[model samples]
Target: MSNDLAAQHRPALFHRAWTVAVIACLTIVAAAAFAAMPGVLVDPLHTEYGWSRASIGAAASVNMTVYGLIAPFAAALMDRFGLRRIAMTALVTIVVGAGLTTVMTDVWQLTLYWGLLIGAGTGSLSMTFAATVANRWFVRRRGLVIGALTGSSAFGQLVFLPALAWIVDHQGWRPALVTLALTAGTMIVLIALLLRDHPADLGQRPYGATAFVERPKADQGAARRTLRVLYGSVRDRRFWLLAGTFAVCGATTNGIMWTHFVPAAQDAGMAMTAAASLVSMIGVFALVGTVLSGWLTDRFDPRPLLVGYYAGRALLLAALPALLGPDSGAVIVSWVVLFGLLDVATVPPTILLCRRVFGADGAIVFGWVNAVHQVGAGAMAVFGGFTRDMTGGYGPVWLLAAALCAVAAVAVYGLTPTAARTGDPAKA
Candidate 1:
């Protein structure tokens, strides 16, 4: 009887793991759909409306800011209201925002639709969502699962950028926006049909927990709990260091580079398609880098991993200005390949650091830190454009980003090294 029951349970376990993979894939597609928009839209909006780069950048700034700011609350809300409901709502919201964006003529409308609405929607589905699902569903190979999901987020850029750029270049920007709306609307149906908030909802325990171990109680008053996590985190020096370093991470990568790289490449006489392809290449390398970073995080101290990443980023950014022109060839490609490897690779180590320092509230604390990261990114998105207008080139901005990375490299070392070992699987 016992052997028969064990045989029967194996397939059920496989089903649960399969469900987690599907949810992770859905999250990846949603992330990619929204993330690919800003870069593809930048040049078209500039040419079509004669909008200043600064004005267009401001809308991106708004999008990035709202995306970051809402993350913690969104995480809390998911915990309270359930993941499937929140995820479905987020998809619908994105559909509305992207669909409406196709018709906007004014800058503020662009900001309202793309910046605020789409930003809010995507915020709910960010890395926090992946972490939540990984934590709740998987016990074994959790690190690998989280890394895979994070890579999917980076892969979203790779999957969407070329097609999006092609659409904007040949068809029109409106069609690109419409395509995004439809993609998101399709995801809404998938989420409603398949997503489950927890494994327990399907009569399974988390993958690794002992069957006899009681499930942990859900936090009552998730909103208040989220606020307390942020407040308590503020009092910790390690939290500040993590947030500060990650803020620079956001500034250099998502803020300045993702928003402006294509335009800057175009300024150097590259085709829009070529520039977008280069950005997508970065996505490819970022996927590899982030997943490897996750493996490193599980085995080594994350502090050193982060230090190495920031140093690599600083070197690459410093080289960017010289590598921009059409004649640069292999040198430019090498620079981009290296830059992509370091792009969002900062995330896994950053997540590790948050878990180390904040313990039980690590995920929520990471949300607040991520908000600061976006704050930095938003500031740089607007400032990079303004700097371009002032200097007539992106050279100065690249140098500034390199300088920030250097500063971050030094700043990360100041974090409490004691925190580095916390929750390390190797240590376990």
Candidate 2:
């Protein structure tokens, strides 16, 4: 089909929906590959380079900060150029970063490869992709779709962590890097083959948008109105509340959990393989929880869900130190399942809430909110490492995390739908 003709023609029903699923899976798999690499590499890198845990964590902090910094820009870029192009670019960047990491000699090289390059790549592949897809796709199943997509990240971590750990153990971190690079490259090819920028780009309506009408011409005045909606969200109290809560979410999950969990387990005398397996177990439940969160987002007020997740997570965090034991396989397994399920599930609901609060500009607004999440995560990652080095234990850090979760649960509960005063941003 001619490009112009395809642009003007009606899309085949259900084709773009499938395309979205494929794209979500590919984007998430690449992201997961990168995310899983760090946890697996932490110990090996420390042993090989004689680096301090604080220094390694500092590198991860840089990566997470960059990851957050990229989110706002990523949203804007996606808004201007579209998701497919931006996502493909991100994937390519990740492949390069992963491939180059195999040859690193100094800790600085680690910072350059994993901290800067991989961070930027994964940042681009972050939750903003989930928000964009949910906002542009189905009206009815938006929550479920987003949930499944969010779950893909966890699923990626679950499936890859143990294998990557094994690779690092058997062949060193370099081989693991090569393996991840291959996985990312393979996904990039899949994305190129199947992904589309939008349902409209494929000549079909969004799965649930009732009528596919051409947007009104945007003269300067109408353009200002659109910009106002985007800016107005920044000024909303509820936006800040949601952002704050998500910041805690980042601190808990990516910061303490992904960045330090493996090391912490080791400190408790757990073997490397056992720690990785426990983390993998968390990934399994994270997948299930994220999917369920998406389903509930479509059916109930997201505030309560956030409350439940954070509250439960706080209790688990409080229990962790007491429950932690080298031979307590069942206890560790239970912790992994409970914690993993709650980990990233906050994402879909947060995105849904952003759309309800920001309308057409939800992606960019979410970009900003997600930035807060990253910052919190980055701070925790660095702090957790420092605390461990200073005190020779993770107990205090886990306690702090529990406190943060409680604060977040309270903060999110304050996010009333009418809190924006514009009422039901879905209509905008």
Candidate 3:
């Protein structure tokens, strides 16, 4: 196969990679929206069901844990079975979970539906999904595609948060849950109708490839292979570096900030709508930052980029305590803008690092790294609530996250650099 020969079969409207990227982005958007819903529901659940914050946080902790832990396996499954099949199944699972969440009367049901089922489902569509799509589809613009997809996750929060908050505030939490279910249901149909497993399925090479690159053969026993990777990864210092840094990334952003920020703001007497809008603002800045980080990953080394991002985040988090008062409008706005920029920007560079260090198995390796990230996140999600319950405020948690960010900044600097296989022309 020649480049020109592959070009001859290209679709008129867009590259199939772009089409797949769009579907992947949409899928992630739906999943991200569901992930953000718990934050908005925390107070409402307390109000309606008389659930304690710690109990709600515990359910979120379970969700976060399952969400992260399932990712590596999901990546392996996607490789062994098929992307479209896994994606479609994930969407259906999300629909079932979210639908059941609306009718749940007990906290354990919340844990089962939202924590186990929805968490696992959303895990399938996480950054690993973005990395898999980018790795399998495009050789030339993988970083940009990653950024776009990552940004789409942030954009999902931007689009859904305010409105969902409004619905939760005005109508009720049930309506908000129903909205997520419907969104997942719609994405399931879209994935089933439009998504293909791979470009090769349509008789085309990966975009930017001259010939079909032979992928590594999947291990005959995926479970054993995954366990082997986990065992091997534990001994590989580079994996620890990646996993440790990402654990902080998860702890600060998804675990502490996303899960607790709304309630933290509420504790300072901010309205739900106002707090949700602030989070939406963070989403807006995150979209820009993640996309820009993606572009930078293509052109520069990711190690320094991660160091800078972490350092900046530390500074922002360190300043958060003084910024969280009724009269701190200017400080709050600045925090939202700065924090959003740093929010998910860690993803692109982290993914780049995975590709550089892990080579052919980068996506799945990242899935394991992400699992650690979520574990850290889950720990903090529970801890943050418990801290608040014990201390009557989130001030200490913010400071703790800031300290973790500082550690991540120093830790990322220790990572040895490797050549990124960005857009390998042979890899289809």
For model 2, give the 10-residue run with minimal summed lDDT: 215-224
Q: Judged by TM-score, which candidate is best?
A: 3
List lDDT for all candidates, in order. 0.80, 0.79, 0.86
Ranking by TM-score: 3, 1, 2
Could you tally the backbone clashes for each prediction? 0, 1, 1
Q: Which residue pairs overlap in candidate 1's backbone?
A: none
Q: Model 1, residue 118: what's the lDDT? A: 91
lDDT of 2 by residue, 1-428 (tens): 68876555544456577677767766776676677766767778778889988888888888888887787677666666677788889888888888877788888887898889989998888888777766666665788888888788777866677887888888888888888788777777777787776666656677756567342232344334435555777677877898899899989988888878888888888877788888888878888999999999888888789999999999999999887779886777888888988988898888878877766667677877888898998899889989988999889999999999999888886776743244545532
Indicate the residue-level lDDT of 210 in model 3: 60
Residue 223's lDDT within candidate 1 is: 88
- Model 1 over residues 309-426: C-alpha lDDT tens digits? 9999999899888889767788888887888788877887777667667665767888888899989999999998998888888888899899999999999889875542335443
* Candidate 1 regions with alpha-carbon error over 4 angstroms: 1-15, 212-220, 417-428
* Candidate 3 residue-wise lDDT, 1-428, digit = tens: 78887666553446778888889999999888987887898888888899988989999989988989888888888888888989988888888998889899999999999999999999988888899899888877789889989888877866588899999989998998888888888998889888887888887678776677665465567677677678866777888999999999999988988899988988998888888889889988998999999999899888899999999999999988878766668779988999998898999989888888777668888999999999999999999989988999999899999999999999997788755344432222
The whole-model C-alpha lDDT of candidate 2 against the native structure comes to 0.79
Residue-level error in angstroms, candidate 1, position 346? 1.3
